[model samples]
Target: MPWKELRPMSQKLEFVEKAIVPGANVSALCRDFGISRQTAHKWLRRYRDQGYLGLVEKSRRPASSPLATAEDVVVSIIELRSKHASWGPQKIAGVLARRLGPEAPSPTTVARVLRRLGKVKRRRPAARIWSVDGRPRIEVKASNDLWTIDFKGWWRALNGDKCEPLTVRDAFSRRVLAVALVPATTAAHVRRVLELLFRKHGLPSAIQSDNGSPFICSRSRGGLTVLSAWLVSLGIRIVRSRPGHPQDNGGHERMHRDLSELQLSPARSRRAQQRQCDRWMLDFNHVRPHDALGGKTPAELYRNSTRRSLSPLLPTYPPEWLTRRANKAGYVRINGDQVFVATALARQLIGLRQESELRWSARFFDVDLGMIEILPIDHAYLGGTVMETVTTVRPSERARERIPVSA
Candidate 1:
């Protein structure tokens, strides 16, 4: 009977065993085993060279793989990951290429190495919310085109001093113009910090901020807080994100996240915290590679604005407008009736333009502060005295005997 050939492994072993016996015919075994002469001879050669173990399946992989990533390149990727735990492979590869020249592994290869090394953390990405239907999307054209400001939630320092950091970042370049640790998020404190930033960085075209204290007031017209009002007075447009929407100021929020992580080792005093902030600001602007900036530091892309910083004094109005100081109470007495301006302009000069005898227009710098209408006096009360009383007006009420006022 012919040797069993049902299983390839058993067939190879049996064929080799019978053919190796002295005086056995290899051709006859090939015919009986349903294998060609070439196949029988190949198996016999392998068995003769390596014994029965060689008859078992051999790996099909090549002996050498020149296309595989180099050991040193993988090592370098691991080293960079160790140095910056938060950096992904794209940034890692960027840095490695800069340091190690053109031969550095690609970002995809680096990602693979990270996975092999158990450094990659697979996370289910959050569903992308793509609709910007009502959101104000500002296209940043240049460094000083737009600036984003925010107060990172306050935290107590080791010395028990509350530190509410006012962060100002160039929206286009990601340059952190300031990271001042203020005692509070009051309009005055934030305004002072912004004044210094404006003085150093010059005036931006617009300032984008979240709807919060000093930036926005619920009671104020157009949600213009004192700080925003002050910015408008400087000819800088004020842009506020939608309420409860942090994604609108995502880049600034990301910067705040980095700033928070920088305080890993808490500073005992405000002075120490400020020193750390300054140091981090320097690093963030000059040292850290920004992925959005093509791995270049923020300082590399940023340039001071062509618009020179003003003295922070009230801007000069035309001669036709009447200049009055917004008294400590943030009101201007018009026709014996007190009108509320903004506290930000408190003690600061504002202009009032009389559009007509009974109508007046209030202004701060170039920004209009609604028109004041002389309301009819109560003739029954005080012998027909026309002491005017007014109410807040909207900008849309141009011809409606009302003036558009700034909130």
Candidate 2:
């Protein structure tokens, strides 16, 4: 919702307070107001602090200052706040409180300390509302509990090709499992990347992504996409960032910013970009110490003691589902549905979780096959072009040949 559409702060606070009463339907009001319950509470917190005055319009600028503070003290706060401008009084206070000990005043004093040094700028309303709280306030337990996945917003390369980074990061370790660059991000490409991750990392307990088509979160389809559906069948839950709230997936977004700032630059060529990305992923997983993790690297955290090495092969699907073997032609017939698979998948069986309706659920190996977009109940296949499908198999046979022909 536009700022013009929302009522004044006083009215919003009043309405939310009234709506928050028992049986008042807070969710409905939140939807109507285009705000979250958290946002509503934030205003409520201000209301409790300064009463109706808090509800009144106020400047982001500080209203008070501290008396006779040491120059070093003020300067230190300045440097810290400069490093993390998004940090609030509470976080800065926590840092100071630990240092100053018995002499630490209130949070207001710390804000004043920052203010006196001129480190704390008057909060910009737009910046305050738009900037995310990326303080690592949440902690991840164990490896692979959650993987934040997203296509890095596009960036231009020196070669003129657009780079859309596909990133999958473990929430627990902050470990970036993959950072793939492609001209375009599509469901098929993303599926291949995810397949590799699954084969290597076992699986995450859940994956969080945006509502974009590639990520596939829509009310009409209930956000079910090939990727999400594949994860779900493996007993992995999927969480979507709230609509219009990009900060809901702050970790992945921050990683994108870091990549742009530190790894890949606009002047780098395609090969250079790939090389830099490869180096960055290596250092990010193994070398860079995470402040939130007490200076530990992501690799130290992504390791799952529960499962050392990932299983060598994909698991077979359950027996109940109708199974059809892909012929040499890479086509399968199941429940009258004709699926044209890549020729490389020949001899591999695809399972269809037969349902009561026309819809069919497909599975491959342990990972549930999400992208089972078979052409027709009987049509051979349709994947961009017939030549495109045929060309993909040549590399796989070469790869097979590269391996020893026999033991």
Candidate 3:
């Protein structure tokens, strides 16, 4: 279908002689070459104008036109950069193109002109503090895959009760789920906050907490405290940061910094602190545009993403779990004896579940109890098929003695 497929010199000369000569007919020549009459005449005119030289090839390239950046615009850009040199190309582009007008040169072109003029600063890049690189930095695309939970590093208040502000936020949405001022951030308190979160937003797929005593107990024989064990019981995976590594839970850590800077720094009293924190969370979740969410509130991204909800009270199962009622002190009462599993799993009957290789775990209601491993199965992780047998073990005499004798 292309013109070049035909014999080149033969077709060219044929057109040149028959169609281009003084007495040639354009129509007859076009028919011979199997080309349109317009095409034949075009070649004929070119040949007639320039003779054989017209048949030769030339470059079919376009010429470039220099875009002149106006003096006034250039002056303004220079002035702005002089004032705030930290402003980058995109920021400048946004101001000039969107706010100013179409007359301004593109950001890249502006940058080039500035660079040529030696107006841009030569900043020696900030010294890179070496860090552990194996902890792969990643962005969570959705809510509940990870929640960063940490107590804002402790500080003494004027009263000196030692305010340890605990916080939890969705890694993806940055939704601040809880911010509480607790007298002490014990495993029990951590469990309570988690219970509130689970009851409200449903359980997350996993939680990321630091490897400290409450979040993690290195001293615990299982390397996990009762709080972590409670999480395992709920089938929620728990991830911990490297020892003494602050960046491991960077999202929550950053959130704590922001909270400390913008929210907590102003409060004078614990009551005021809690009240202001509540207000700040409302704004943070619904109003403030998150950079991560592209200036949208965290609430805009986080949704109800649970397979099921926690019932009003932990659901009861068939009489397979050794029935122990939780007393006011949050200890299980069994055979008039008590053994505290963990505060989080309190007030519920626990059944030992059987897993592969003769392992077992304790469960309350349908939730896995996250506590240190009970022998025969690691309690921190429940890898077992559901069993339906009533647990028959009574609390040992020593455990019964440990329980507070109450009215």
Candidate 4:
């Protein structure tokens, strides 16, 4: 036969009732109720002092906790969290340490507090899958070694106006150099913004961008666009991310994710939206702490490049190499014939080196254009009286090769 379960309160009441009887043995009642002598005495004392209500269970919690977080400190954490809703416990803890000094709680404590207060939401762990693309990523050792630029996808403002923000960031320091609102995605508009950035922050060794309009032309040789060509002229190496792979620039994409999370509601106007972006950028650079940067703000690690922005942005070639400026129609005169280069490279200097007797290699700065083949054309139309010079240009197979360090 199975034993019937007894409620704690009912058992205590029965034991107390049996013990209260005149000449009842309390030790016998304690053993019968399967309770210790001290417990039986405690229950009997409470019963005598306060009748049947005392038989009920009482709380075991202490009246106070000495190591509990202070009300003021908790208020400060909550306030900071309320201000930057997108920040995690680590970032919040960083700000707290800055504000509260030695009294600041650790990230774990902050996480506990936030979780207890229902401010922190549990997120699923992301899969740690490695993606490989054969191309090597540009190594960033200093502030201006590499800069990543991209346009955040456009969204409609509250007033129904489109808002597209151009973001430029230093790869090493993770500092956002600029967040400008361009009127269009044209090369000219982007160039104007970049010119200002170059003047302010100086030139980076390389600039990375996706293969999109204003950055690259898919049909063009080496995916060079007008902006990229100008960048090449300034002696900056162009790094391109693989098509359809945003993970190639994961850090920049994560920043965009933060921006999206913080700025959920669209502003009233483009100007207002820009002002919001400016505020967000200021906070992102100065206030928000990055886990990848050891809980330090980007502004703390970022420094302007030593390479200054100067006029007459022309690339210097070796003394042995021959140089020629392409005409406005993107044609360069090789020997006696005009060969078409790139429209993006119009008016840019083209370096030529003789590879063989009939074949000559053409390069724009460090980028190889192609092999320029000089062919003798016998004109039958003019009864072979005049010899016509024909130039045949083929796209260089090595055009998409890795950029040189000197570039």
Candidate 5:
């Protein structure tokens, strides 16, 4: 009893034909065809106007959009995007706002326009949660609270020369402090570069790095490499990302990703590549606006640290704490017995505080190495008190037993 859905045009034509005939009652026809009088009249009017084509469904969209982005503004956005293809909508919006004070479109509008023009690629959503197995998160409140250092993965130049640049960034301001194409990735080379940075930017309270060469040694006590040990001697805390997990230092990795995106192709030579990296670092620090920093460039928020780099000296300990100087082989004579500490701690003074009758806590500067347990000598000829084993216990683990948890 309902109007035909598959052939609505045919039904409309039929109704119009019948209604056009003399004395055809439109209201009676509307009742018989189960259509409202208004719909019947509308179809008849459409047929009268354009013979039958006018009865076809037309677009419901308005003929004109007055509130849409102006053509000139869209052209400017496209031009800016063409200039900096890697910039996202948020960054583009920031530029547009600076260029066109009150007339700039919002980031959402820019995203929509870019998506419509096939300029934006959809990215897979990343996981929001990341856990680092009981490690306390370092809170960065100021510019020099933490610094992240890493070597950008090696890529070959057009001439087949390797191009690996060491990158260091301030964690709080996201300012890139250094990007140098070192001769090698050895500890000495990295130490030289860091010394230059320290003298220039002063010193950060802590430096973060991944578990890699020149940064950490898996076999060493506390995973301290020579470079990190030098940093520790300068009174800087060394923070390492979890082994095999790059997300522990996600911000630093994200910066590397941006760098990689910008330098898709290698330069002509290593020197040229170094120059390119230097340019990128300059732009990243001064020009590129960061969304996390509320659309401010890293250079705007960064400040040089007040802690100047000084000559490395032996750390003084409490009068009650016993101290031992590590020999060249990283062995310390404790109660007439030789115990091996880390070679990274070689030629450095270590402080020991007795925690129990047989156990003592070892520390290099402020860093706690672990607890040392003294064992009695089996034979009478050997020394009576012998330091047998050094077991590594994290400060967190030691405090977890005594510290009460709040509900």
Candidate 6:
């Protein structure tokens, strides 16, 4: 018979029966059985002591595993993993130790228990090298000093309606201020959500966002849309992450990852999704432990901003800056010379400050609207001079390195 087909119990039984025979040649029996002399002696001893049952296979497991994780600790780890399925062993261990004292299992123990329970999922290493840019770093002095906002990619709800979520997080404390599901990505919807957040949590010193609709306009002046211009008017500094550089707002992106994991499946309706998002925001701020925050929840570090929100009003510039109103065509007329300012600023007051004898800088409120230069109307009898803004539009570079907003 092939060695692969041999059964350990059957082989041991045959060997023990033959060895028990009187005057049996044990060495020849060992050679026929293809087993070592030590193995033959062990089976013979077991058979003499406990008979046929002793010749059967025996357990190789140790009698006691002193270093193994305790049953209660393993159960606790699995329970925590069930709550925060995305959290790894280190975070789970940290939380358990903080709550259950030093007797809690180590991170490695927790990992082993998770593996035994089939709760671990291995992820392949990304082929793309992780890179970060180091520019436009903003200092955070206190809570509400900086806030990062973005839209999680939209998905269809069970009702076949598209649900787009807008998330706003405090950069300093990693507090999630808002997570609202809206029907569209329009400025009005975003503005309403921000206004609610501002009234509740107060206004942040600065708001950071990517160059996208409602936040920026490439064709508009300073890439400022109406919503952004309103923010500038509210005395809030606007900071835009470089185009195509998501790491510029790394903290916000990380939060989006967590949110994506929570939203693995969409809800049936807009109301249901909003309710679910609200509950997640609560748990994220109050319960979830952040590894970067030294195992502290965001609510522990976050505080209400002292810089309270006020009714937004038009901005006023210094008296030296000449004030001119943009006409129906969004043009500022200087001695009958029409210069295009910005279409968004139509019928709005614009401040003009002469940078030089031939050049002038136009601004709406405090936002700059580029420079205009004077050129004489050639071969005209009236000799009226023409003033026009110089335009040199170039595609924005998207590969620029951006420093992490939180780090």
Question: TM-scores for all candidates?
Answer: 0.54, 0.42, 0.44, 0.60, 0.60, 0.58
Going through the candidates in the order shown, the clash numbers are 3, 2, 9, 0, 0, 1
For residues 182-265, what per-residue lDDT tens digits would candidate 3 score against the true structure? 777787888888787887888887788767768766433234456775676566766767777887777787788777754336
Least well predicted 10-residue stretch by lDDT in candidate 1: 398-407
In Å, residue 381's CA in model 1 sits off its true spot by 6.9
lDDT of 5: 0.81
Candidate 2, residue 99: how far the Cα is off, in Å: 71
Global lDDT of each model?
Answer: 0.78, 0.64, 0.64, 0.80, 0.81, 0.77
**Lowest-lDDT window of 10 residues in candidate 6?**
398-407
lDDT of 2 by residue, 245-356 (tens): 8788887888888887633346466556767778889988898999989999988867752433433343466777777887776577645444554343455566767553
Tell me, by lDDT, which candidate is best: 5
Q: Tens-digit lDDT track for model 4 on 10-70?
A: 7887888888899999888777777889999999999989888887788998999987998
Write down the worst ten-residue block by lDDT for model 5.
Answer: 398-407
Question: Candidate 4: where is the Cα deviation over 4 Å?
Answer: 1-133, 374-407
Task: Report the alpha-carbon TM-score of model 3 versus the true structure.
Answer: 0.44
Model 6 — TM-score against the truth?
0.58
Q: Please, what are the lDDT tens digits per residue for candidate 1 over residues 1-407?
A: 35552677888887888998999998988888888999998898998888888788889999999868888888888888998999998999899889889788889999988998899898954422212235767889999888999889777779888777889999999999999998877889998888887778789999888767878775444456677777876779777787779999899998898898756777898888899899999999999998899999999999998787564545788888777887886777666556666666677677888877767777776555666666654333333343334544445442222222322
The true-versus-predicted C-alpha distance at residue 72 of model 1, in Å, is 89
The runs of at least 3 residues in candidate 1 whose Cα sits more than 4 Å from the true structure, single-residue gaps closed, are 1-134, 221-226, 312-328, 332-338, 347-371, 379-388, 395-407
The whole-model C-alpha lDDT of candidate 3 against the native structure comes to: 0.64
After aligning candidate 6 to the native by TM-score, how far in Å is the CA of 340 from where it should be?
A: 1.9
Tens-digit per-residue lDDT, 321-401, candidate 5: 999999897777677656666788888889988887766788888876766665554332323332234333444432111
TM-score of 1: 0.54
Question: Once all C-alphas are superposed, what RMSD does model 6 give against the true structure?
Answer: 25.7
